[model samples]
Structure formats: structure tokens, C-alpha cells
Target: MSRAFRIQVSEGVQRIVHVEDGVQGTIDVLPILAPERMAELLATELEKRGYTRTDQDGELVLVKVGEGNVTVEVNVRTGTVTVSIAEEVQVNVSTTASGTAENIEDARKQAEDRAMRQLEAAVVPLQEAARREATARLEAELAEVRPELDAVVNAATAEALVEKARELGDIESIEGSAEDGNLTIKVRV
Candidate 1:
């Protein structure tokens, strides 16, 4: 006679998940000068604002590491800026299952498989939640950084305008504040 057996199994999974998010935006530099000169002017302006300049694949990139592990990268040639952040989260999931079969080994195997499947199913939701949390954090950081980035772009644009005006002729006088988003230059050709 074959006897039935019951088996129970429990499984736990722990993972350190890395979550990241980013946003991309463009800055209008006005094209007041040649592209190369515009890029050079923007790079200089960003360097003055605490961004480090680096060349990536022959493209000029300015990088700044900010609070909360946020990294900002500006591509001078393309006027594209990317702000990104990363966070690590710990996920722990456990599941228990029971199975019955004629053979003890078969019962145990069935229980183990069920428990593992349950654990796997639980992991997806946890990872999705972590991703959402990371996105929320990124949004918050972006809100704080947006205005400052806009100001930097404005300053760079003002500087470019001044350089263009000089190239046009002779600048007799300059007026207004770049910070106020208004600049006036009088040039004599």
C-alpha cells in the first residue's frame, strides 16, 4: 500500500534593488553665434556655476553632482540637460505553501515550487513600488533644481548676446542685469 504524505515549505528572498530615474530638457541658447562658439561660451558659463567640464565622445558635457545623489549633465553642443538620481532599496519577501502527494519527495518538491513561485510573484510588485518611490524622489529634486538651471541658462544666453554684440561692432555701453532676464547693449559699427 502507498501512503500519502504532506509537506510544507517556506521561502524568503531578500534583494537590494537599485532604482533610478531621470528627466531631460532643452535650453534655448538663441543661436546668436556659431555653434562651436555658442558651445564654448555655455561651457565657460557652466564652469563658473560649479559644473565640471568633460568631453564625451568628442561632445562637450558639463556635470554637476548635487544633493540626494542627484547628477546633472548638460550637453553643451545639443543644449540638452539630463537630471538623474538613484536610490537603493531593500526588499524582503517570504512565502509558505503546503502540498500533499503519494510520495514524500514529490510532496516536498511541489510545496517548494509553490513557495518559490509565490515569492517570485511578490517580487514584481515590490520592485514596481520601489521604482515609483524613486521617481517621486526624482521629481521632488527636479522641482528644486529647475529654477537654478533656468537661471544658469539665462546667464549663458546673456553672455552669448554680449559676445555677439561685440563681434558685430564696438560695444559703447552695456546695461541691465542678466539675472533680471534683461540686457541691453549699444554697439557702434
Candidate 2:
């Protein structure tokens, strides 16, 4: 192998910020699913909040973060929700990167320090309110999922029970009716 005498110098800053917001509440979830409608409503809310629609898989919603092309994930769960963004934005810079060696020694040294500071500055400010923004947006959107689940279940179950009473073999005659979710069953054996 031929003798190699060379130097390489590179400078840059990589800024990555991970922002997540989580909140818990007793939001009611209905067992029945109209997922397509649900997703449409949810995606609408996310779009309103500055998230660009990218792709969706099953129950997961993915959006592109505006400033840095970061990936944001929204998870909709029963009684809970979480939004998160994890991405890296690069602000690194290269100095005289030529000849390498003694020539870049001074510039590279200075740039390295500046790059570090810039990275820190760019990401720290986002941390202060990113989570809050996510939380607030999610909270507002979560209202759509709220429904009178308990009332619906109670009414349906009651009506079903009345219908079942008519099937009892011991009953000679039966009358069962439901109105306004109120069930009336009369059986004569």
C-alpha cells in the first residue's frame, strides 16, 4: 500500500429535539367503531393544529412537523391520549474542509464551538412549549370521542332483556315494547 498522508476536517451541528405531551382523563369511549369517521375528524383537528398529513396505518396517525420535517405521532386511546415528536434537524457547518491539516485547525476549532451552541439554542426553546402545545391540541380534539356511552348501553341492554323475557317457555303470553329507551315487558304463565 502506498503511504497516505492526509487530514480530514469537518464541522457541523446536529440538533434533535424530542417533544411529547401526555394527559389523562376519564373520557368515555363507545365500543362500537366507525373508525373511518373517527379518523377523519381527528385528522381534521391535527391539520388545524399545524400538522401536515403524511400517512396513517391502522390506529396510528402520523404527521409531518412544519419546521424540521420531524415525525409526529398521535395515539388515540380510551380515556387517554399521547402526542409525540421525535426528529433531528441538522445545522452543522463545514469549515475550510480543504487540505485538512494545519489550515483548518483554527477554523474548525471555532466552528465546532459555535455549532454546539447553535444546536443547543435551536432545540432548547422548543422544549419549553412543545409539550404544552401537543397537550392542548390533543385535549381539544379529544372532545369528539366523548359520547353518552353509558346511557346507550343501559338503554340497549334493558330493551334486550325485555325481549328475552318473552322467550321464557313458562310464559303463556307476553308483551314487550321499548319506547324512548324505556322497556315494558309483561309475561303471563
Candidate 3:
């Protein structure tokens, strides 16, 4: 069986955008880090690293986007962000019954098949252990990659905020950072 990891991003673009000049500015202005765009950027990054975007959704957002399994959700009123990516692997387990054929050769073959099936059942634990190891290895890689990912995202978010600020009115400065899985942006409106 083939194994793959699916990535999901929820609760993105969590920032407070105050329109000081609502009369002069566009009435409807959304954050730069929209959930759809967030998912696109993330998928682009993952694809560059060799993770094919599949059409099967993992365990996050209930909605499906395009044909891929990855889901990106956006909420303007949410303070919590959720991201989940999981690979689903199915294992077949079954035991065969002994044959009652009179022929010795047929009976022997049937017995062997049953024995092999029993062996397969017994080795299920080993398969689970290996799966756990694979998951742990992926988590370790995530810990190492998170910092760099955050750096890129942080820079992008800051740029978007500054751009937005300039678009609205006379903005003094823009500052942003990513910590504890939250993107915090402060703009001087």
C-alpha cells in the first residue's frame, strides 16, 4: 500500500483590521492572509517539497476544494487556528479456513494459505509500530520546518498588512510575528 500525508489549514487570516477612514476607504476589506490563499501558498510550498496534492480530504475542514484532499478554511470572527494533515492507510487482516478436500495436495495448499493468513494477523502489531515510527519521524521534521515556514509567512503577512494600511489611509508602520501557531499583526491606523 502507498502512504502519503495530507495537510489542512483552518482559522487563518486572524487579524484585527480597523478602518479609521471608513468613509474614504473601501467598505469591505479582508485580511491579506485569507484562508484560501493560505492554503494555496502552503500547498505550493508542500508541492515544491514533493508532496502531491491529492483529492482526498483528511480530517479537517468538511468542505472540499477542487480535486485535492487538502482543505483551507477562512473565518473573520475566529480567534483559534486549526491545521491538520494526516495520511490514511488501510491494512487488510483475515484468516482462511482449512479445506476439507480429500486430495492431500489440495488440503496441504489450503492449510498453508490459512497459516499465512494467521501470520499476517499476528504481524499486525509490528505494522502499527512501524506506522507510529513514521508518524514520529514526520513530527520531528515538522518541528524543524515550522520555524522557517513561520518566518516566510510572517514576512508575507507583514507585507500584506503594510500594503493594506497604505491602501486605506496614512499608515505609520506595520509590525507582525508568528508565535504559538498564531499570526499577530499590529498596524498603526
Clashing pairs in 3: 54-68, 54-69, 55-67, 55-68, 55-69, 56-69
Tell me how far the alpha carbon of residue 54 in candidate 1 is from the true structure, in angstroms, after superposition.
2.0
Evaluate all candidate structures by whole-model CA lDDT and list the values in order. 0.87, 0.44, 0.41
List the candidate numbers ranked by lDDT, top first: 1, 2, 3
Backbone collision count in every prediction?
Answer: 0, 3, 6
Regions more than 4 Å wrong, model 1? 86-88
Off by over 4 Å in 2: 1-18, 23-104, 148-189
TM-score of 2: 0.36
Compute the lDDT for candidate 3.
0.41
**Is candidate 1 or 2 superior in lDDT?**
1
Highest lDDT against the true fold, candidate? 1
Ranking by TM-score: 1, 3, 2
* TM-scores, all models, native as reference: 0.88, 0.36, 0.38
Q: For residues 107-169, what per-residue lDDT tens digits would candidate 1 score against the true structure?
A: 999999899889989988998898897787777878877887778778878888888888899
Q: Evaluated with TM-score, which candidate comes out highest?
A: 1
Tell me the tens digit of each residue's lDDT in model 2 across 61-174.
534333332233444332233333343333333332323224455555555565556556655656556655655555554443233223323443454454456555344543
Number of clashing residue pairs, candidate 1: 0
RMSD, each candidate, Å?
A: 2.0, 12.0, 18.8
